[model samples]
Target: MSRLALPTVIALALALSACATSNPDVIGRHEAQRMSQVLDATVLSSRPVVVEGNQSGVGAVAGGVVGAISGGSVGGRREGQVAGVLGAVAGAVIGNAIERSTTRESAVEILLQLRNGERRSVVQAQGSEQFAPGEAVILVTTGGKTRVMRAPPVTAAPPAPAASH
Candidate 1:
């Protein structure tokens, strides 16, 4: 394989792996301008958790192509053919593993209690906001996805002035 081809294949794999995200801070384009249900709750407990990675075939395909080309350039014609097949298989497995590991996310599992004494558990990718036991938070749900965020302090509204006749 040409030196340039290897780098291009690697760059494509990296770009594809970066496409998956479960971060609470990131809102998808489709979610914008949509109304969400908000519920008040208090954090009962917070714990660290791991969000599993995804398996998309793009990685395997990319790796196989790169490996075949690279291995095909090795040894005599017959030997190169055998090596190419083996390299493609090995490369595919390694690439899939890389994709999975790169996409894994560090997250948190939160147990919360609503004002009505109802309890809910949520696991989300760790974001800028952190939850602690006894901390007040709001659960915002949009399109069936929920995110927990710190709630603003309650403030009493000022009285309105009398209206002119």
Candidate 2:
């Protein structure tokens, strides 16, 4: 056989071998393997959180000075000190409220705990009812959400190193 023909035949044989060598035991978890059934579930809940205060440079300094002066006037020096503290606390609360009002909280995350102890979370709109933690939802690992099957495990050899530029 010609040298060129030999290389072509060898290349075809290698391709055939690679195809035949794929793992028989490994299978699509979603389509072929089937859902093992959810044995148990747990619903995830979000904790109510108070937002931190954001005091702006000019506002914080000005508020502090005014609060201090007002507090000082009623009870002399000691009263002024107390007033300053009260003023700072009030200002901080107001500042935090303003910040929170501007930035609304995002959707709550729902977690599903399987009997097998596997857990997954889905973000749902705020106030929306979510799947109870123990609810049975088919858990199929895939390349993307909603896709049923996962790609087969790669068994190809590592790619050759690139040539230096």
RMSD after CA superposition, every candidate: 2.1, 26.7
Taking all chains together, each candidate's TM-score versus the true structure is 0.89, 0.24
Off by over 4 Å in 1: 157-165
Best by TM-score: 1
Q: After superposition, how far is residue 43 of candidate 1 from its true place, in Å?
A: 0.3
Candidate 2: tens digits of C-alpha lDDT, residues 1-165: 233433443344334333321122334444464544322344543333333323333333433444444444556677767876886666445434443343333344556665577765544334323344334444343334321111234488999999998
Which has the greatest lDDT?
1
Q: Mind giving the per-residue lDDT tens digits that candidate 1 earns over 1-165?
A: 446766787789778878767788999998899999999999999999999887887777877887888788889999889988987998788778777787889999999999999999999999999888999999999999999999999999998999999
TM-score of 2: 0.24
